[model samples]
Target: MAVSQTADTEELMTCLRIQLYHPEPQNIFSSLPMDNRLKQEAEDPVRLGRAAEACPFVLNDTKVSRKQLALMAFRVPGSTEMRFHVQNLSRKGRLQVNGIELRHLVGAELPDKALIRFGRYEMLVLREPGDSETHFEVLFERRIVAPSQEMGEGEARTVPVMESEDVTLSWREPINEPSESDEYQNC
Candidate 1:
């Protein structure tokens, strides 16, 4: 009985581990290596709430500032998209990337096409009316990229991932050029 109990304990441990650490498909992102994401189910209500909120309508920027949004970071999300989507509940506001107005940013999936080519473009969203001011400064950061008298560094190089169209095509040239056109030209 003692040996059997020890065997059962080992099996239970193995089963629990598999449940806790399933990978692939939708892998959970974490700052921890050994820590199981399942164990973090009860960690933060606010964060969970934010994720839930953001996933549907709030789904835009991974992080949002509650204060002055003086700086914008229009970096390529990967080797792909250079624009990031943001939801501004601030009412009557202007968001500009490197002085380029972000009116191009719309829809949940479409970020502004103009904001699509910056290593890290800086933006300033000025709220003129409605909502509140407390939201601006708390969420804002310094220019995403520092502006200098040396402006050469500000040139945008990031390309939008979604805007890329497949241009690779194969064409079959006329095996005998003039078989049709040349015979007609003789007339």
Candidate 2:
């Protein structure tokens, strides 16, 4: 029983990690808290912004426009196995990879070691090295109690486990191809 519980806990471990970086002025290192539950519950495309109260990963880029949505991360569809794709959410700030603008690229594959910059902030996207199960399910256990010497009440039943699957707002648009732009060239 203990071994099975341990395996379950390990299964809940984070599969992906997003590291934050900034230039000389804002040199800070931080990792976003990403868990299996958050990934499983998130919509197709995950939204990110600067607003602490709004975005899943609240970015602290003062140079970023307050009205901009910042960025969007999503899992590629049409296959059982999928990789993450990142796109710029703001039209003002360009998402650059290797000093090249990402305005033309459909979506940059994540878990990439290339330097990523937007506004005054830079980021490194990485994945944890481990075997992970793609299937996700929530389990529930129920229990019943009888009135003998334990309880004064006649008969009582309790739900020891409960699973919730309510879908919340992810503030993300459906993953799609980028529009044609003559201004920015492909990187």
Candidate 3:
């Protein structure tokens, strides 16, 4: 029993960690319920795009068109190494890795901290849990998308800043007395 459990653990450790970032406000699917089959790579190569409902990670950005598939990721047949492939759906659609726009590159070996920008979305490719460098915190300034003073509605998106500070806020004095009338307290 222990040996089988260890094998399962090893298989999970070989999987790649993919993080999605976008210029638009997007929900982090870490808390979302993942398909058991997909988690085990039952589908082999997972399809990801606006139309891929079975995709473990789905992008819900406005800039992403729901016309065709955008990206594909899979593990090497018998190896633990993973590969990422991209498909340009639109004439103006593009994918960028680490700020380098890939025009002719169909597939490439995913490296640690590899930044992928597909359409208006940016994805961070990370190694599995074994890497110490993969553990870090990301801080976002604001939650909702605020109207930009310069741009029109829904034109601006908040960018998240990487912060090292563990303490988010400083301690404040505790309020002893209630702001409302004290008569209610006596009752």
Better of 1 and 3 by TM-score: 3
For lDDT, candidate 1 versus 2, the one ahead is: 2
Per-residue lDDT for 156 in model 2?
14
Candidate 3 per-residue C-alpha lDDT over 3-62 given as tens digits, one digit per residue, 9 for 90 to 100 = 665553333333444444444444633333332222433234444544445443344444
TM-score of each: 0.20, 0.47, 0.45
TM-score of 1: 0.20
Q: Considering only N, C-alpha and C atoms within 3 Å, which residue pairs clash in candidate 2?
A: none
Tens-digit lDDT string for candidate 2 (1-187): 3366555345542234444444453422222342322443323344456655655554455666433333333344564333445666665767654343555223455442334556655444443333233522211111122111132222111211112242121222434568877777767
Candidate with the greatest lDDT versus the true structure: 2
Model 1 over residues 1-50: C-alpha lDDT tens digits? 34665553321110011101111222232321222212111111112111
Candidate 3 achieves a global lDDT of 0.39
Locate the minimum summed-lDDT window of 10 residues in model 1: 11-20
Instruction: Go through the candidates in order and give the clash count of each.
Output: 16, 0, 0
**What is the lDDT ranking, best to worst?**
2, 3, 1
> Which candidate model has the greater TM-score, 2 or 3?
2
